[model samples]
Target: MATHLITGAGSGIGAIVAERLAERGDELWLLARSAKRAAELRERFPAAHTLVGDLADPGKLSWAFGHQSLPVELDSLVHVAGVVELGPVGETPVKVWQETLAVNVVAPAELTRLLLPQLRLARGHVVFVNSGAGLTAHAEWGSYAASKFGVRALADALRAEEHAAGVRVTSVYPGRTATPMQRKVHQQEGVAYDPERWIAPESVATAILTAIDLPRDAEITEITVRPGR
Candidate 1:
């Protein structure tokens, strides 16, 4: 079984993906921002390993990538950690904008750069959990949209650069999934997007696993899964 490392593994899509990876007998290194959440994940997947680090911090990201305690290489990396900050362009604070960009774009890019050697060793895959916002613009989501667009571009470039090295980069655009982040968005906007109608977390997790398990010759470049309605 291949070894997988997932960031934002504390909750939402990240947590769900970790659970599924562990269920499938894949060894996992879960990175969470919170110690409590890391402990919770450890409890949920007793067989899986855990790492606690905040990707938003440059030092933490460096520590996570450079630490010798963990394996120097991984067979796959599922980048599910990102931020969504909603506000009109003028109203958004500089700090909020930085945080969003850091988590959604800069952090992932830096992590990828630092971990490139490790991935190259394993000739592994990179899974980016993107958003529909990355594909289209929406109101008051400028920061988030910009970050995701950068993410998409990064994924595309990585795929092109690593195709010859047997590294597969898959970008998954999941629209309106049921997660705490979505719920927060709904509360702020006063729009109750139906959970049942939305794409379930497990469904998206399945798509991720499928991409990881695919034969090296076949590549699922991009998958956009949304609510049926």
Candidate 2:
């Protein structure tokens, strides 16, 4: 079975993706923020492996991973974890911007750098679960949008650089999925959340699966998923 490493696998789209991969009998390495979270994930996916490292502090990830055992080679590395804080640019604080970028962009970039050797060894794929905000920023989406845009740029550059090495990179930008993150966004906007109104997290998970499961002869560089409703 192919081996995959994934972050943000604790809930929503990430959880669904992890479940699907497990069902397919693929080897999974799930990244958790701490020992407690890792234990929780192991309980969630009994057969999967767990790695503990906090995405909130990207600077310490390398140090953290040095103390853990990583997969020797990964068929795919999927980044799905992210944090968001909403406020007008004039009202947004530096800490919010710093934390948002740290988790959403910097940590993913750092993880990719640290795992490049393993990814290269497997001629693997890297998938970034980006957001529609990465393409267009709204009134209170400044920091989160900036981070997603940075991640999109990172994916593009990595794809170009890794082409000769047989590594594939894809960015899946999903619009308003029915995830906990979406619910939180609605709360931040002071709006009621109706899970039925948005795209289901499973749909987004399917899109992610499609990218990674495609035949190696061709690659899906980027895909955008919108609500059917």
Candidate 3:
């Protein structure tokens, strides 16, 4: 079975992706911020290795990965952890911008750097769970859009740099999804939460799985999933 590491596996798209991988009998390493949620995942998927720590903290992330006795080879790494703080550029808090970039861009970049050796050994695939905001910036989504744009840049650069190394990089830009974070966004916008109006997290997970399942000769460099209006 292929070994995969997934970030933000405690909930939302990450959790659904983790479940799909587990169903395929892949060995999984799950990184989650919540200890309670990590414990629950451990119970549900007893074979998974759950790491609890904040992705924004480089030191904590390093410590967690360093302590784990993972194999020298990894088949896949899926980055799904992110934070959204919506506001006009003038009104947005500096701290929110910092946190958003840290989690959405910096953390994934650092983790990928750390795992490069392992990935190269396996000629692994790296998937970045980006967003539609990465493509277009909305009025109140400057900070989030900026971070996602960084994600797109990172994936593009990585794909180009690692092509010779046989490491595939894909960025999946999913539109607004039915997730807890979406609910919060809806609340912030004073709109009712209608799941039907959003894309399902599982659908995104399926797209990711398709990328992972592709032959080594072919690479799905980027995928954009939009809600069917």
Candidate 4:
């Protein structure tokens, strides 16, 4: 069975992807921010493993992982965890940008670095669940958009650097997915949240799966998922 280490498995698209992979009997290593969250995720995915590391402090992930046991070889490392804070550039504080970048970009980069040997050994895939904001910035989305954009760049450069090692990288840009993060985005935007008005988490999860499950000879470099409606 393919083994995957996934972040953001507690909810939304990450949760769905973990469930689908588990249903197929794939081995899972889910990343949790703390012991409490690891316990909760263990309850949720009874057969999966959990890793404790705080994404809020990317600088410490190396030290944290040093104390934990990581997979010897991994078929995939999925970066689905992200944080967003909506505000105009003039009003957005330094902390907001720092938090957004920490969770969305820096942490993923560090995590990938930590797992590169395993990923290379298995010829694995790296999936980044970026938002459409990564491609285009909109008003009131400065901080979040900037982080996504940074993540997009991270994906691109990693793909180029790791291609010789057979480590495939893909960035999935999902548009306004109906997730808890989307709800928070709506709250920040001062608007109503209608789940039916947005893309389903399952669709984005499917996109991620497709990229990872593709034939070894090919690579799906990027995918943009828009609302079906």
Instruction: Report the Cα lDDT for residue 137, model 3.
Output: 95
Among all windows of 10 consecutive residues in model 3, the one with the lowest summed lDDT is 63-72
Per-residue accuracy of model 2 over 102-155 as CA lDDT, tens digit each: 999999999999999999999999999999999899988999999999999999
lDDT, each prediction? 0.85, 0.95, 0.90, 0.96
Best by lDDT: 4
Tens-digit per-residue lDDT, 1-229, candidate 4 = 9999999999999999999999999999999999999999999999999999999999999999999999999999999999988888999899988898899999999999999999999999999999899999999999999999999999999999999999999999999899999999899888999999999999999999999999999999999999989
- Angstrom error at residue 131, model 1: 0.3
TM-score of 1: 0.93
Reference-based TM-score of each model: 0.93, 0.99, 0.95, 0.99
Residue 1, model 2: lDDT of 94
TM-score of 2: 0.99
- TM-score of model 3 relative to the true fold? 0.95
**Considering only N, C-alpha and C atoms within 3 Å, which residue pairs clash in candidate 1?**
none
Instruction: Give the per-residue lDDT digits (tens) of candidate 1, residues 25-56.
Output: 88888876767878887887788787766778
User: Which 10 successive residues of model 4 have the least lDDT summed?
Assistant: 92-101
Question: In angstroms, how far off is 161's CA in candidate 3?
Answer: 1.0
lDDT, residue 176, model 4: 89
